[model samples]
Target: MLLAVTRQHEVAANWDAASLLADGSVSPEAGCRELPGCWGLAQPGPGPGDRGPCYAVPAAVGPQLPDGCKAPRLVCQLHFTSWPDFGVPFTPIGMLKFLKKVRTLNPAHAGPIVVHCSAGVGRTGTFIVIDAMMDMVHAEQKVDVFDFVSRIRNQRPQMVQTDMQYTFIYQALLEYYLYGDTELDVSSLEKHLQALHGPTAHFDKIGLEEEFRKLTNVRIMKENMRTGNLPANMKKARVIQIIPYDFNRVILSMKRGQEYTDYINASFIDGYRQKDYFIATQGPLAHTVEDFWRMVWEWKCHTIVMLTEVQEREQDKCYQYWPTEGSVTHGEITIEIKSDTLSEAISIRDFLVTFNQPLARPEEQTRVVRQFHFHGWPEIGIPAEGKGMIDLIAAVQKQQQQTGNHPITVHCSAGAGRTGTFIALSNILERVKAEGLLDVFQAVKSLRLQRPHMVQTL
Candidate 1:
């Protein structure tokens, strides 16, 4: 959302000045009353490092007013997490959609929009220019970005700082002229859900279908699978058809000059609140099983969701990577089952995973890992009921409440169909719970940008 202000806390926290911010969050009960001169946000049920772009934080700001009243100011803080520092957003559409919601909250008549980034210039100016550019488009069907930028610099030097930042102003404006906002509100959720599930498109394209087309067609950046296609790494893929793009592919920690060992058929997919929220991968092949556990250890993920059985419908869907009863060692990693609980819909297993340190190293490392296996859906077709998936996601969320929202490892047969669908649902549910907004088309499109053919079932 800026030219230099990249991360969340670097821009602003709890709608306060960026300079006075740190990387800590407050519970709802412990408000700004504890910190005299600082801003505090009542976290709305998100684990640490889990809050995404466009999260609504209930904040309490301390006052140094002349009136001498020591009351705290209640504020609604909107944070956008994906905008790269000194660069434009990957999806200009997401920025425009955020702008729409911002206008809703900060009406012109109410007061001036309070905008600030780290340096008080680049990102701040870009947002102000975009707001003005869109207003000009609406009123006169014309925009003079150069003229506006020149004017803004007169007021404050270096408003739109970088060449990419200047170019991005036009990109966002032109995107509005090309593809209008396609995000869905919570109020109209039923209509789109019906369009997705029902046989209603007789002649005209369904609304959801049109939205999906827009999402796939207009990717602003060129995407390619560079490292995954190398001759050395091709053997690791479970399904040749699906591979992650080079941009968001999860890279393994390189040992001292280790070659090609870092490649895995996994992409870091974004959840509603954070990037790399899910490490989506293919079902572990016999040779690739060790790489899968290595990914969990490297990424420090505590939760794994397996969407298919070891063999489904007489076909080898996944290899049995874990032991049925006791501990199993793969490479240096030893996984022991601490407990197993199964319901009609899901099987929850807790494993005590230990990595034997090298003889030179001082201490052994151990972690508690939880795997949620759900095989209720049919292998060939859709599920009999949607509630099972919703509840299954709820159970995963319950575990995330304990794990503090590290990147979750999700695998299906090809890590494309059911894996993608589950991630999209997880993202949508999280966004809806926090912001009351849904854009199924945008959600799936974001996934496909990271990896190929996510949400393949839909």
Candidate 2:
């Protein structure tokens, strides 16, 4: 059997390691289960799948060897799963990771590494340069990017397609030289966290504080074309620090009367298995409560996870936007609280949120939104309600499944610190259950891409 491993866009270390057969049959635990078009036929494995590109490991590609042939010829192919169909990856860390894995598994004298994409020019050439340059950097401790690209283009005119891809080659090298290898195995995660929490000298070279400081790069790298920062949208934000990253921010195009007015201080944070899984936003301000309801209506959100109370520290962190009784209207949207379950740590409220606009689609008329509000958070102290938090997450996930597959709305005072913790908790919990791996750092980093300053503590 041939060897292969698959990973998604994010750093999904929890995915099962699969052994691929000649006929594209994967181990029973393979993560993806979809019938892709380019795959020709729907096989149980991840191969010839064009709909969602995946990776193939170093294998001897050819007909079955003679009865007991020794030292068979080896042919290796590794597709860049993290690379986009259009552009290079957002960061070189993931690409560097893929390269490290390939080098480690590849047996000595494995012929050569062959990389290809659709056109076999842009990403293809870029990947070749990265792999080649890293070798030079390790042996000679020097790099000539322009010289290398020019040297490569001599044989193939299409090598190193765009300036961005060219720049990415350098970014990948720099990341490698600076951070050696940051990808941790799932088994070593707990030990790694314990080390990060202490002030030991082992972590002194690159401490937890330094790792947290990398959020600055994560923000600048994912450049924002922001409407949240605009004058018209600024007032809608309840917190000055919570500007939604425009890359995945939700748009409000279905407004009834307002034209050219689609703006909300909300960003789409990806979940363990889904993109745009959670809408991370600031608690609704007094004037923007209507806008908040509009977001719920537009996204057809099924769950709202409120991590903070309306009034905290004698301040109105969130405006009173829900009713305890029958129903209430907030501009173009109305909310009716059907049931309110109270507990020492969690207060569950079921809401029937509706848009007053006239539309043919009945599904858009109203949606059942289960709000999971936790009262365990202290204004200035750390939370100690571990069991309650897990229970709340269980209830929320149950509600998400009972309802349809819709994005979950999560918010706090600024939607970064507390909100991020809950989302990461849910994400990490779900990943641990499904993949048998735990990587809290990767989960936190994913949140920062959608909105800045997510999961600020260890």
The prediction achieving the highest lDDT against the true structure is: 1
TM-score of candidate 1 versus the correct structure, residues matched by position: 0.80
Determine the C-alpha RMSD for candidate 1 after optimal superposition of all C-alphas.
6.8
Separately for all candidates shown, the number of backbone clashes (residues 3 or more apart, or on different chains) is: 2, 0
lDDT, candidate 2, 18-99, per-residue tens: 4322332223343333234423321234344211112434233344456866543434445555554344677665576567
The C-alpha TM-scores of every prediction are: 0.80, 0.78
Model 2 lDDT on a 0 to 1 scale: 0.70
Best by TM-score: 1
Residue pairs with backbone overlap in model 1:
3-86, 52-273
Off by over 4 Å in 1: 1-52, 55-82, 140-144, 192-204, 218-224, 255-258, 358-364
